[model samples]
Target chain A: MSIFETIRFALRGLVANKLRSGLTVLGILIGVGAVILLVAVGNGSAKVIEESIESLGTNTLTISSGGFGRQSSTSTSSTSLTVELATALADQSAAPHVKTVSPVVTSSSLAATYEDTDVTVGSFIGTHPDYATASNFSIKSGAMFTTDDVNDHSKVVVLGSTVAEGLFGTVDPLGQQINVSGKLFTVIGVLAEKGSSGLSDPNDLAIAPLSAVQESLTGYGSLSQILVQAVSADDIDTAQAEVTSILNEKLGVTSTSSSTPYRIMNQAELLETRTSNAKTFTTLLGAVAAISLLVGGIGITNIMMVTVTERTREIGIRKALGAPKRTVLNQFLVEATVLSVIGGLLGVAGAVIGSQFTIMGTKPVIVPSSVLLALGVSVGIGLFFGSYPASRAASLRPIEALRYE
Target chain B: MSAHRANRPVLDVRNAKKIYGSGEATVVALAGVSLTVHRGEYVAIMGSSGSGKSTLMNILGCLDIPTTGRYLLDGVDVSKLNDRQLALVRNRRIGFVFQSFNLIPRTTALANVELPMAYAGVRSAERKRRAHAALDLVGLADRADHEPNQLSGGQQQRVAVARALVTAPALVLADEPTGNLDTQSTADVLAVLDSLNQSGRTIVLITHEDDVAMHAKRVIRLVDGKIVSDQRNGHLAASRSAMLRDAYSTAVYR
Candidate 1:
């Protein structure tokens, strides 16, 4: 028989049992859809993390106290990061790759009030003007506090977008005074809105001049952390090395000591770690979805077996009519393949449409390779699972099959 | 008898034997049976249950191979043919009509009739034309679009007969063709077979009913896997020839 005629026969067989065929298709549909949708969600979350990390600037490095080591009583005082160390790191001749250094001190859960509005700030940060450049924070209205304001110990603060909206609503707080821990400070600027990263909200904090904040709220303790920017992306490693060696010398700590009290984190290294972690997550999700696809393939095998058994007499009739074994095998194999192919195409459509909306605060980003792999696997499943049942039908003897009830 | 001998033998069976099991609990379905049927002959094989008639019918239809001995159909030694070649032989040389009218469910009568021709690799247009003509011969021309379930038992059997003849095979084997039909429907099916035989088509009917076997020109009775009698129905043959002559004369007069 011709290929076209075989395909027609297969289609007729499928149509004869529409409900069973539809259910089989639905099984494959869910599997393919799950594969594409889950993988897309995984990839999307990874992309979100990468973008947030990239926004922090690849050329920047953060030097913070409290490393992954046992703290020693003798080194506690020397391990504290201070403005003196920050100044030393800022010296061009000592660390030529270090473009800027901003010393930061944070006071968590600070109560601030403005007239009738009262809100608790997540982080009240005290840093120099270069903190804006180091942290990639751009001012939306008004200007950042200048170096002169830090030198003069001005009581000025910049509100993050979320904090500003919470304290002032629609009021312009650029020049208005807000009370922070019983100290009145003028709002010099409002930072532009930045969407929250999955781990934390970046837009719910406030920044102030380091000297005034230290004098009022912190009382001149050691700086919380130091933000350092490299001259270029390629200089981040060199800049980190320079900072590490200088801090070691200034604090009288050995470079090879296992109990070092300070840690230098490169943004690039953090980015690599995060991206690899996301890759692992995507693979995990794909594996889970692959299991469902395999189940769907088994569903095909189950349905085909049932169909072969149910149509045994019809197969006998065809055999008696001179149909070759290959023809019967092809007919059934084609039927299974058509079922899975239809389900796969519909699943791709479902994934595309589902990806258009945000899922769990992450916009799904469909990976083209995942889509192609899913479709290819679905088709392969049809043929692989379909072969056994089709062969069983083909191998049936004409007399025995006709004798079957 | 001389004229029948002059015709080429369509079926040549030389001491065909069929054994069921190897050792204990063995059953012999056919025991050293040898028979020859010529072209354009209407032969009926009759036997009670377990008389080996069904086994011989299966062998003759090419649905089963003989355990020992040679059987040839249309001059081909089907005993030695492989499964694929046997399937081809069955498709191009033999037509089968089962007692149950095994039409593929949910398929139109026309497609059912075209099945054999399709397996023979006939083109779609030619298959359709020949299928329609065969259905017309069985008086089911207007029921071509009906499914098997939609047709009555008699009509369904007639459709099976059409399917059996559409391929113009060397021999038509009917296994209890009227066993499932009522008396009236049996008469209708037998009439169609008689007309087909009159038009020079070879037919082999397997039945246990003496009344059904009476319609055939020759009857072979089997008992315990052995043929007990083989005789010509001389009176039926004469009446059938007279009927054919009367119809021919009427056609000429018209």
Candidate 2:
């Protein structure tokens, strides 16, 4: 028979066993859905990481004490970074590519209160005035602490937007006093809100003059980490090299080896590492999901085999009616392909709906290419897995089949 | 037994032999059987179970090849053709009516009638027209849209006959076409076959019932892989020719 007639016959056969056909389609539906959802999650995480990197500003770098690389005894001794080193790095002659520098010490779980409204700041940061410009922070209301305030160890603090809202609500907190670890400090300024970025949200922390936090909270002379900003995006590498040498000189280290005393994280490298990691995770998840697709293909084969056996008499009748073996084969194969195509379309719909649900704590991103590819694979699965049963149907002897009852 | 006829026979078999298996398990289904059937002949092959009638019917239908034979079907050496060529021969030259009606389930009567021509690559429009005409010939024109399950036993068999005739094949091979029908349905099917034969269609029906075989113009009885008797029904043959004469006169007057 012609291909069109054969396909019509196959469709009729599938309709006769609706429940079985629907169940078979369900297998492929789930397989494609899993594949699309996992791949989407991978793409979504990569996109989220890229956006976070943009928010961090492309020319900024963070230099923290304790080297990230292999640390031996020689490298370990130079890990002690003091606030004095930060002062020397601020000099233009020592690091010409550096635009600004800020020494920072961060402590977690410091409760601040104004009257009965108590707020636990996620992070309490102590840094100099340059910290505002270096870390992309802006003054929302009151003025920032001055250099004299830093040197005199003034008890003055600047609340991040979220912290300010939590501490004083609509009331002006510029001259109001709040207790930080039982020590009263005057609120001098409120930094503008910076949402979650590649690094933690800057608006969730409270900032103060370096000297005040050093004596009142941490009671340490050593600085936690330093925030550095380059003169321009193109000068970030040069600024990093200049800062490394300056830090080495200030610590009296003559040799620079693989085990540096401090680690420098540039904005560009951070973005690249995170995006590549997300891609790897996506590929791994996609591979696992593909295994279920393979199983789904096997389900098609199993169902096709059963259909061929059940329709032996019908095959015999067709053969007796002068149908060629290839016609019989095409009928069964077309039925399987139809099943897979229907399942694939349903899977695309399911994946789209599934993507809205959070996976790995992030919403999935369904890639168009992945949807098309998954659909193609499902059709291919039908053809590949449907072959044996179709051939078996084609090879049935007319006389035996007619007599099969 | 083969008979020498004035005209070329539609089916001619010489010493046809068919064996089921090899060596110790061998069962010779048809042993040195010979037969000849001319065009427009309504013949019945009758025998009990294990009498090799099915084997003979299978050979005539081109569904199986003989172990050793010279079988010429409409001037072609059917025994020498390959599986695909044999299928083509069946499609173009032979039509089959099964005992179970064997109409594809869930299909309209018209589609079942059109099936053989479809396999023969007949275009859709012509296939539909010819299928409708065949159903009309079998007196099932009104039931063309009905599925086999929705039709009575006699209507289903009539649809089968229409399917067999749609191809205008060289031979109509019916194996127990009315076995599953009631007495009234059997009479209805036999009347359709008789009318088809009267219109010059060639038919070979396989059955063991004497009453069913009595409807045919000739009867061949098989026993132990051999033809035990070949008899012509003088009364039926005479009446068929007289009816043909009457049809010819009516056509002339029209």
Candidate 3:
């Protein structure tokens, strides 16, 4: 028979029993839809992390205590990072990509007031002149604190755009005095609006000179940590290797069992880890969804087998009329493949709608490539499941089938 | 079994055997049966229920392979031909009609005739043309668009006959083709089959009614899978043939 007639015959058979065909297709749709939705959500979260890493301070290398991880120390257990070490690293001329660096003396309890409404911000950083340059902060108003500001204990501060707005709305608060825990400090500069960058919240920060923050309210001479910036993004690898060696030596640490002294997270490592984590998550969810698709194929197999039994006389009639086994096999296979193709297309449509429904307003949204791959997998499912029942139908003896009541 | 040599019978079978089930529990459906059908001959095989007449029909139709025996179809050993080859032979050399007027339900008369050729892989245009010619031969040309359920019993049988004739096969196998029709319908279907046979087509019919078998030129009575009597109708079909020719000529003249 002509190819068109074969399809026409198969389509007629499906149309003859509409509800059965719909139910079969329904199984496939849910399988494909689940795969698409599960994979999209997992990959989307990973993309958010990547976006945070990319928009962080440009050319900056972040170093923290490694191996020991978080909760290694509240005070004096692990290797202590000092401002003197940060100063030593900054004074290097041999490292060409080495740029301005800063040592941070961060603490939680820092108070500030402009008019009267002063909310205690959670974060505070005490650093040098290079702190502003290395952190990618663009001053919106007055100048950054000079190296002399740290040396002379000048109580000067620069507020992030959000913190500036919260304390002194629309009013130009530059050249004004802000009380920091009962001590007056001049707001020399206000940062321009560059929203949240990586782990740092744009709001809730108050920058102060390293010497004044240590001597006045804090009353401690120790540094919490240090920050470094490279001249360019490409120099991150070279800069990270040099900075690691310096911090390990400076922190007074010998690599021991309980601690590796300090930790480090550079721009390159951050991006690399995020991508690998996303791949793992996407694969895990995709596999779960694929199982559902396989279940759908089994559903088709179940239905085709029933159809064979129900149409026993029809098979008898065709066989007696000289229909070869291959012909009978093709007929059933066509029916299954047609059902799967329809289901797969419907699944793609459902996934697209789901992406819009779930993602809300997050940027750098996940792009689903597996939805298409899943559809192709469904076609293979049809061939896989359809084969057994078709072979069974073909194997039927014409005389015995005809004799069936 | 009778001897069949070169330039001999079109179909020859010797000691054919067909057993249902296996070993100690087997029931023999056809036991050492033998028969022959020549080209351009009309033969009727008759038997009651459990007499294995239907089983013989199935084997002759190539729908079932015989368990043991040498059955030669036009001098080729059918016992040796595989399932696929037997299917090819059935498509090219044999056509079938059933007592139930086994035209596919809801199909038009033309499509019913076209169905056999379709399986034979004939091109669509040729299949359509040949089906139309077969319908014309059965006097169902004007009822070409009539579905089996829409037509009268006689017309439906004529359509079945048309289906059997469309492929121009060497043999037309009718298993009690007129069993379900009334006397008038039976006469109509018999007249159609008679005309086909007169046109040099070989036909084998299976029926339990002696009245039905009277239309054939030869009769083989089967009992319990064994042939009890095999005889020629002798001068009965010759007289009937002349009578049918006169009747058709008068109808055409009118």
Docking class of 1: medium
Interface RMSD, prediction 2 = 1.1
lDDT by residue for model 3 over A53-79, one digit each (tens)? 665664787655435553444455445
Off by over 4 Å in 2: A42-59, A68-100, A107-111, A116-122, A128-156, A169-175, A181-185, A188-203, A209-222, A230-242, A245-258, A267-284, B1-7, B234-254
Clashes of 1: 0
Of 1 and 3, the candidate ranking higher by TM-score: 1
The local lDDT score (0 to 100) that residue A134 gets in candidate 2 is: 73
Best TM-score among the predictions, by candidate number? 1
Task: List the candidate 1 regions with Cα displacement exceeding 4 Å.
Answer: A66-73, A76-78, A82-99, A219-221, A231-235, A242-261, A275-288, A357-361, B1-7, B234-254
Worst 10 residues of 1 chain A by lDDT: A67-76
Clashing pairs in 1: none
Model 1 has fnat of 0.83
Question: Candidate 1, residues A52-162: lDDT per residue as tens digits?
Answer: 887787889999986675454555687789999999999999899999999999999899999999999989999999998788889999999999999999999999998
Per-residue C-alpha lDDT of model 1 across residues B1-254, encoded as one tens digit per residue: 23333345789999999999989978999998999887767899999999999999999999999999999896789998998998998898888999999999999999999989888889999999999999999999999999999999999999999999887777899999999999999999999999987776778999999999999989999999999999998565664564455344324422
Model 1, C-alpha of A129: deviation from truth (Å): 2.8
DockQ of each: 0.71, 0.67, 0.46
Ranking by lDDT: 1, 2, 3
* Clashing residue pairs found in predicted model 3: A64-A263, A65-A262, A65-A263, A66-A262, A66-A263
Per-model TM against the reference: 0.89, 0.86, 0.83
What fraction of the reference interface contacts is present in each model, in order?
0.83, 0.77, 0.43
